[model samples]
Target chain A: MDCISARSKNIKGKGQSKLKRRESLAGLLFVSPTIIYFIVFFLLPLAVCIYASFTNWNILSPNRVFVGTLNYERLFVDPKFWKALKNTLFMLIPIPIYITFALLFAYACHKNILGQKVFRAIYYLPYISSIVALTLIWMWLFNSKYGLVNNFLSLFVDNPPSWLSDPFWTKWMIVIMISWKLIGFTSIYYIAALKSIPKSYYEAAQIDGAGPRQQFFKITLPLLTPTTFYLLVIGMIGSLQTFVEVQMFAPDGGRGYGVGTIVFYIWQKAFSSSQMGYACAIATVFGLFILVITVIQFTLSRKWVFEGN
Target chain B: MKRKISPVRIIVFIILLIGAVTMIVPFAWMLSTSLKEANLVYTIPPQWIPKPVDWKNYIEIWTASNLLTGIKNSCIISVSVLVFCTFTSSMAAFAFSKLSFPFKNAIFVMLLTTIMVPLVVLLVPLFVIYTKIGWIDTLLPMIVPASMCNINIIFFLRQYMTGLPKELLDAAKIDGCGYFSAYWRIYLPLCKPAIVANVIMLFMITWNDYFGPLVFTHSESKQNIQVAIAMLNSHYIQQTDIPLMMTASLIAILPVLILFIICQKYFTESFAMTGIKG
Candidate 1:
């Protein structure tokens, strides 16, 4: 009886192992496509980009000759690179402004006011619409002479700034356009965050004689830090990569003026001038810069972001 | 007793009203301009409503630009990529969530890292690779890479699948169902809500993509809607044909606007999910 029981147990063990092996095989088969795709498209391209950045791999040239760090060395001193970086940083000015508006709008809507749904949808409209279409509409709206914006400004001032042509006003136009596009979408996120905060906290604050402003600063603001940090990180990354609007607004890479973002400059160099190697160098540095900034944001967020359930 | 209206509430209402108007004026202007004759576009008061509402610009856009072909190309790219990507991502999600595999965590982590790497970094290398393969002007460059897998969809689906009851799939296996059949017959049906939310998000991103289509395709025949709109803008700006440009912009925005209105719930819900969970 004991021998028979041992043999049965041994057979059961073998059968279970076979089933596990079959499951493993199926799992590997399922993920094979994704693995192959990453290997070919993502990993391979990344390796090639890093390698080519160190060499002179011009698209028009017959051969790519190795020139160690020459591209990187030139990129460090390139005035165009610095100007593009500056413009990209300048684009970040709207992040705080839009986030503030988003928070306010979100707070107002959270009060369950009438027409809340309509307001939410209307705000998110610019975000969903095609950037090209919106940029064109903005260009028309900011038309120096006949634009509705300038026409309105002329009601108060002797002369409105040439929003599209004048370098200074052009920057403000881009900022305004960006803020308008982002505010609604950012508000959606804020609304979600606001919804997640417990009403008990506010009720507690009210019992403690906290005014609306005190309740907001004491309870609401602290709870919303996580959402704010998330938006800030995302907004920073997006600002650093601003391209389409810059390209659409100033097709010449904002040549004499300083309106070109980093991605715009990279696109111009890589595609337009065929400076593939140098563009790769700029791109590599930019990517690393983003990675570093993101890491720093995450680290700094620990100090302020609320981690409560 | 009737509740009294607070001064603060009234102030908030007025502020929201102003904000809503600011958000909508551009779109209202776009529609107004599209209905205006070319000469009336630059009128001094910037006609909020055209003197005589002309629909000629709307009719002229089809023949004057590559709008038709752009729509066709965009549809093809968006549809093909979404269909293939949805299938592969779900399958991968199923495996990651339910099945046991070797080095699965390592592979997933590697895939997640790709999300952090910006597309601009890959531009030079990808452009080079496409040029070498004579795919610079082809839709294949835009379609193929994206169709392989969407990491975001896979990640979202995996999180969703993990929340589903394990006994559901185990019961299917006991009934002699293969792993693929369990995924298809059981998990896929159960995962519909999550999949729909992801599909809507993917559709929006793929449809609204400007940079990918812009960089990959050069020819007028091959251009997508966004690029086509851009081309029309640059081409007509020299002639200052603002009305025609407005008409084209309206046409380009209409499909997305319609989709957003129809799938409004899924759109906001998916965004909220990503924001909070991410």
Candidate 2:
């Protein structure tokens, strides 16, 4: 009986090992496509991108002569690059504004307001709609002469300022457009965050003699920090990469560098001018900047984002 | 208990109503303009309703530009990418969530990090590579890379799959069902809701994607709906054919808008799910 039991145990152990191997093989097989894809598209392209940045590679030119940090040097001095960076940074001004509105809207809708569902759907419309369509609609609406915006503004002020043409207003127009596009989407996230906060917390706050304002500040806002931080990080990254709207609104970077984003500049350098190496260098720097910003946001999030224990 | 109609609720409702109007007015204007004749577009008051609603622009847009071809190209690209990527991503997600393998977590984490790498960084290198491969002016550039796998979709689906019962797959395995069969027959059916959510999201994204098509396709025929609309905008802007432009814009947005409305529940719910967990 002892020998038979021992033989059975050995058989079971061998079977288990074989099953484990099969599982491993299957897992790898399942993931193989993704692995191969990442290597070919992501890893290879990234490697080539970094390597090509050091060379004076131009699409028009045959030779990709090694120019070691020269492209970087030129990028740092390029006025268009600086202006583009400034415009990109300047667009971030509306982040807080839109976030505040989004939060407020979320808070309002969270109260189970009448037509809340409809309101939510309406807000999400601009976000899901074609950016090209939205941009064109906005362009027509801001068309200085016939635009509804200027038409309405004319009733109030003598001059509404050429929204698309005037440098100063063009930035604001982009800002308005971005804010309009983002608010609903951001609010949806905020609503989700709001939902996840326990009803007991708000009840506890009420028991502590906290007013609506106090409850919001003390309990609600703190709980919502993680969502806020997430939005901020993504918003910052997205603002830095702003392109389509800028491209459409001011095709030539607007008058005196009004709306050229970092991506737009990189695009122009790479595709328009065929300065592949220079574009790669700009892209590398821009990518690093995004990385650093993301890292910083992550690090900072640890301090502010309330991890509900 | 009869709840009182509070002033606060009223105030909030009023504010939301105003905000909703602001959100909706642009679309309203787009529709209104699309129905107006070109000569009537620049009126002083800006007619909320055109005097004679012209449906001619709608009919004319088909012949006016590459709108029909644009729609076809967009449909091809969006549908193919979503279907193929959804399968690959779900498969990856299944492996990551349920299966045990050496370096699985490490691989997933590495893939997660790649999400942070912006598309711009890869633009130049990809363009060069595509040029070398003669993929320029073709839909392959847009279709191939995306169809490989989407990291976000994989990540989301993994989160979802982790919530599913392990015993189901165990039972299937015990019944002599292979790993692939378990995934396809049991897990895939159970993952319907999540898959539907993901499909809607992916469709919207791929449909609205302009930058990818803009950079990849140079020819008029190869252009996606967004790029085609943009080209139309540039051309028509010179002619000041605002009505025609509006008609084109409306046509471009209609498909996605209809999809969004039909799948409204999934759209908002998916956003909430991903945003919170993410």
Candidate 3:
């Protein structure tokens, strides 16, 4: 019996090791499909965008000329570039306002008050809803002559301004629409972050004579710093890459370069103007900008986003 | 001090309720407009309630705009992509979580870094490649890329898998199960929530993605709902029969919304997971 057991031990050991190796190999094999897919679709295209950045390759023209930094030069001198930057910033400025509101909404939800779930679902529907639907609704709602928003506003003032027609109001309407769409998603993050803080802390705060406002400022806000940092990083990236909404809203936008972000500008240059090289340069610069901003944010996050300490 | 559920709170709720109503009203308006007579849709001091319903516009768009074909194309593409992406990712995730792979960390890091690469950069090159391969119009671009060892899915499932009990897997192995058997029987069933969340996210993404459809698909018959609807309202939105366009847009969004409503917990959890994990 002892001899039989010993023989089985050695056989089992060898078999198991072999199985492990095979399993690992199979795992690698399974993932290779994805790696290859990424290489062909993502990495190769990325390489082209980089290479194209250094040349004047337009899809329209057969012949391509090498031009280093000329596209960058053109971007710097162009007023449209600044306008695009301004438009992006203009859109971004409202994020903090909405985020503050989201935090409040999340706090209200976290309180587990009456009808919390209903409020949550109501607010959150817009976030998950197709942007196409949201945009269409907003377009109708913003109609100059007869729209819901204007009609609602007319109740207060004798005449409601033509929001869609006016250039100044058009971007603001877009920002308002985007922010409303975003707040629910943002609020959920805060709610999650809020939920994670052991209830004991808040209970203890209450014992220590901390009021609602005091607890919020001292405990809730500080703990949510990490969430805020994360949201900011993602928000900046999304705002920078804000393309589709602008494309739909400002198809025939006003003046030079129209009301667009850097991404929109790149889209126009690449697809519309057929200046692949110029677009690539814009992409490179945008990528660099994102990199720098991200680095600074992560560095700054050390002070506020306390993962452990 | 801010009031808690007082008259002020009631007032605030009323205000926010109004806001929420405004937010939700569009869908109702879209539906009504779709049902209303075409002439009644554009009337001044606009008729909130029309005298007669017009099913003809819905019929017209469905038939004239090739919406059925568009919807069929969308369903085929989204479902296929979902299956492929889910299968490949879970298999890859099985390895990441349970098995000991050499050079695993390095490969994982490479995938993570690629997440930052702007998708726009891939546009021109993929266009050339797809055109060369004669896959420009077909659904290959959408499906092939949709399924694969998605880095996000891998990480998500990895985190979920690692948290699972080692005992379950060990017991399975002890019962004469191979690694694949243990993975299939033990791990995959446990990771249902992650799979559900991932599916919902992917559905929303693939369904709503305008760019990929715009570039890859040309014919209205081949296009997804997003592309098809865009073609309907592209050149001039206001000039179009506003009611019909709005209804079509609502219809386009309905599938994902229905999915989301059913899986609200997963959707919320997914968003929460991103924050916590990131």
Error of 2 at B104 (Å): 0.4
Question: What is the iRMS for every candidate structure?
Answer: 1.4, 1.1, 2.2
Candidate 1 local lDDT, A92-146, one digit each (tens): 8999999999999999888877678998999899998889999999998888888
lDDT of 3 by residue, A134-228 (tens): 77777777787777777778779987877765656778888888888888889989999888888898899999999978988988888888889
Clashing residue pairs in candidate 3 are none
Return the DockQ of model 1: 0.76
What would the per-residue lDDT of candidate 2 be over residues B153-240, giving only the tens digit for each residue?
A: 8888898999999999899999999999999998888889889989999998999999989998899999999998898665335676
Judged by whole-model lDDT over C-alpha atoms, candidate 3 comes out at 0.78
Query: Candidate 2, residues A1-309: lDDT per residue as tens digits?
Result: 999999999999999999999999999999988998889889999999999999999999898899999999998899999999998888898799889999999988887788888999999999999899999999899999989999999999998899887877888998899899999999999999888889998898889899999999999999899889989988988887889988888888888887788999999988889999999999999999999989988998888899888
Best-fitting candidate, scored by TM-score: 2
**Candidate 1 off by > 4 Å:** B1-4, B235-237
Q: After TM-score superposition, what is the CA distance of residue B186 in candidate 3 from its true location, in Å? A: 2.0
Distance from true position, residue B131, model 3, in Å? 2.0
Least well predicted 10-residue stretch by lDDT in candidate 3 chain A: A250-259
Clashing residue pairs in candidate 2 (N, C-alpha, C atoms within 3 angstroms): none
Error of 2 at B126 (Å): 0.5
